[model samples]
Target: MNPTLRPRRLRQSAPMRRLVAETRIHPAQLVLPMFVAEGIDEPKPISSMPGQVQHTLDSAAREVERAIAAGVGGVMLFGVPEHKDAVGSGADAPDGILNRAAAFLAERFGDQTVVQTDLCLDEFTDHGHCGVLTAAGEVDNDLTLERYAAMAVAQAEAGSQLLGLSGMMDGQVAHVRAALDAAGHETTAILAYSAKYASALYGPFREAVDSSLTGDRKTYQQDPANRREGLREAILDLAEGADIVMVKPASLYLDVLADVAAVADVPVWAYQVSGEYAMVEAAAANGWIDRDRLIAESLTSIVRAGADAVLTYWAIEQAEWIGARA
Candidate 1:
């Protein structure tokens, strides 16, 4: 073997590997996705996602504090209301659970952590769709944009520093951005779920949010087979004033994530969605894989694929692990 080509030399020691490592996962690059449920007396376990829970309002606040203590960069909040309606009216109501949770977190953290909200209607809609529906039972794109705009202002007024626009609606970013600016929320940011695919990987998430969705969201969300389309969506979001663009179910869409990251002018994020997390957890629980190592490897792979940040359920735990290793 040529001595100069001995790559194993760097891999021979832990310190050498660390020094030569090309990709690293940092606590500051991780964002935790949390759910706060209305009418919950305690943190309720999501059966599909073991070790994950839907927190009560008070518990949600404490979880945010814990995430901050663990050094995670931010928290993305989702609200599960006790009631639902055709138009998802609660989503934009100032007293809505999600809005109240956002207000509480922003007030308590006060710039100590980035408080983000899920600026979508799915959790509040009785039909479990992301937007308003038409008479023909289809998702009304233009009409939904109006609802999204209203929701954006509500979330911003509730003190969310960043809005995770995950509804996959057409013109959603532009609408939300304009509404925010018009409402004097100029500093609020939008983290667009630019390339969210209509994947079966969202099963656990449906449970986490107690989704009433009877059918699929394929009409709105991107198709998993189209890589170029994902990039196009990201580009559109960037042009529409998204501060960051994201690809959901990151492990299954590394190529898409990479493409978005390459063309994105701002930060590009990837979401390790519910199903991805559940698969790893199930395997680890059954002694089929190394839990902590797999978690670290998955996140590192996402970073290596060019994501600037990752939204993951294991964020806090993984952040602590990274800190211990450092």
Candidate 2:
């Protein structure tokens, strides 16, 4: 009654499973997304996200050092400015909080890891929209492009090696690419948030960035129900000269991630977003699931779905686990 060939042989032992695993995760393939807020002199804990914090400039540097020591690939920076305005003037200012942090990181750790900045206006704008609005309160697309172009130059000037174009504005990639080149920032790269969906999993993130959203972002962000549209957006970003493309809230959109990865010539990354991380922490806090194992499993699933790299809150811990396993 015994089978002649047993597939379970590979899954029989931990070592066997490790050795024969088709997908693997490494420290170098993980990127940690961090927040640094103005008006906070200390690392402020975020309640929705149990283990995350809004770090001070110095604390942020210390955290990045830990990430480097753990061999995490990169750090993505988001800024929570002290002031908000109709036009998000702080977003591209030379002395803006985001720009200052970008310059600090680039100056301190340029040779150690990639320095990336979120090129979005939501955290700076009073309306909490990704772009400027007209007198009628509708987002102005072409005018938004102008703001993005200026932000691109500003970020480049601050030494951001990778600009995360996450605003979801039309023609954003082309506009930013032309702006960067015209300003002689030819080497700074773009990581387009190509398949970002207007998902319900961004609640914790809104808190993370101190978002002052007036209305839903459905006007710009893609609908979660559209699968083909995800790939279409990625293709458009690629055509517009994205050095890398990413899908946000990665786990819920494996199909979209795979679709983009299938056609993308550059590296494909995914964001294991704040809400996704918070859900796991909440479950683990209630003793409902094994914490460490699920973190590894969640990340592995995203990579298996075709992500070349992942931006996760667990990047440091996961990298440590990866090293311990090695």
Candidate 3:
């Protein structure tokens, strides 16, 4: 190594390293995903997810206030309906748990921070699939589009600024966008879960939502083995007018995240899924790792991989850490 070109100078001090850092995580770049369930009088702990819980409407609102106070960029809401049906009728019901909670948050906290919703049927459906199924139990792509389009309007009416299309149905983004425009909710944006993978990391999530999944989502969600497909999905979603695009299971898919970020004209985001969080918590519980340090590093790694924003369970805590450090 050339002594004249030594990089050690920048590493000599904390302030010097901070000054030369290429990537930074911000409170506004973190979005916390919340689960609000029906029939729950109190916040019910999601055992698999450790500290997370199925919050009631009022409890969810209070939690959102804390996240907003910490300067988190947004909160993504997932509804857990008490009732499940073949067509997931509760998904678009005006008074359904999800819509009810969404409205509650939007009315009170919309001005304070971004309010987003998971516009999928998994939580409301008895089959536990992301969309409606046919007689043979195969997911009906076109049929699900109709449901999603309706859900879009419903969520928009409930004041969701961003709709997270995580179902992975072909043409979902386009179909939902057309429906929103026709319904006069043109400003409601789509955050396409463009490269959501059929990863094993979703096990804790299913528990959190009380999922009664019929089988698997492999038929819709992308396979984790394909690298190019991730970017292709993002491109397709962008063509369909997605306002923002996301890659799920962030840590393991940095290459894909980078590929999408490199070419995307719109903001690119990543989801640090449940399994990833669980692993760290499990390890930290065993005293194998520093819990807080690993959490911060995990988030920093995702942002460094080209995500403009990150959907993380630790968003609020991360923001507080940032605030304390400042």
Q: TM-scores for all candidates?
A: 0.98, 0.99, 0.98
Instruction: Give per-residue CA lDDT, model 1, range 229-322, as digits (tens).
Output: 9999999999899999999989999999999988889999999999999999999989999998899899999999999999999999988988
lDDT of 2 by residue, 1-326 (tens): 97989898789888888899999998999999999999998999999999899999999999999999999999999998999999999999999999999999899998999999999999999999999999999999999999999999999999899999999999999999999999999999999999999999999999999999978999899999999999999999999999999999899999999999899999999999998999999999999999998999999999999999999999999999899879
What's the lDDT for residue 48 in model 1? 90
Cα lDDT of all candidates, in order? 0.93, 0.95, 0.94
Query: What TM-score does model 3 achieve against the real structure?
Result: 0.98
**Which residue pairs of candidate 2 clash?**
none
Runs off by more than 4 Å, candidate 1: 1-4
Ranking by TM-score: 2, 3, 1
Q: Give the higher-lDDT candidate: 1 or 2.
A: 2
Q: Model 3, range 98-188, lDDT digits (tens) per residue?
A: 8998899999999999999999999999989989889999999999999999999999999999999999999999999999999999999
Error of 3 at 25 (Å): 0.9
